[model samples]
Target: MKFRKATSENVQAIVEMIADDPLGSKRENYTIPLPKTYYDAFERIDADPNQELIVVENDIGQVIAVFQMTFIPYLTYQGGIRAQIEGVRVHKDHRGLGIGKTIFHWAIQRAKERNAHVLQLTTDKKRPDAIRFYESLGFNASHEGMKMHF
Candidate 1:
């Protein structure tokens, strides 16, 4: 599999994968066209130098996975940068094939290249399996993450 930056065209596939899950089905309305918010976010991500919205594709060139990794500069950790990853998803057909591990491994190396002192991500408390998957790859639950949706 190969990884590449997600272009405007890949957004639909990415959202579809996200919606395939029970939790996402209620959130993503795929019965019709995707909402404009997704497009807006895509445009914003494309403009941000620190944000990397990436997609993974198979040898056949089919987009199968998606994630966004952001490199945030900060004064913490002796001024070292931090790499934050989110929206990680693998297509149902591609699950259980080590693609998630490959994505994480690549993100770690990318973080190191950018001089990130730490690589971080937050998974929903409901996703115990995902948390365990992350732990298997050396991520720790060092902090509690909270968010307020608009």
Candidate 2:
């Protein structure tokens, strides 16, 4: 597997990967025709210096996994910066093959290179396996995550 920055042409595959799971199937619409919002969002992400949209491709050059890492600069924590991991997904055929571990290692190296004090992510409570996987990767569930969706 190889990791690379996601290009505009990868938007469709990225969306499909996100929608591959049960939870995603209910929330994501990776259909034949997506709205302009998805493309617009991709444009913004590509243009942002503090955000990285990454894609992992297989030996056959198929996009199998994707995630976004965002660097947040804050005055708190002695003016430390932190990296947030979002939307991490590996293709069904690629799971349990250490691809997720490789992705996290990449993300951690990136965070360290960027001088980030913390690398964090949130997983749905329903995904027990994900929670365990993350914990095994050295992430601690020290606090509860709360969010209000519009």
* Per-residue lDDT of model 2, residues 3-118, tens digit only: 89999999998998899999999998787887677899999999999999999999999999999999999999999999999999998888889999999999999999999999
Output the lDDT of residue 69, model 1: 95
lDDT of each: 0.92, 0.94
Residue by residue across 13-72, what tens digits does model 1's lDDT show? 989998999789888876547898888989999999999999999999999999999999
Residue 71 accuracy (lDDT) in model 1: 93
lDDT of 1: 0.92
Model 2 score (lDDT)? 0.94
> Model 2 TM-score?
0.96
Query: What's the C-alpha lDDT at position 142 in model 2?
Result: 85
Clashing pairs in 1: none
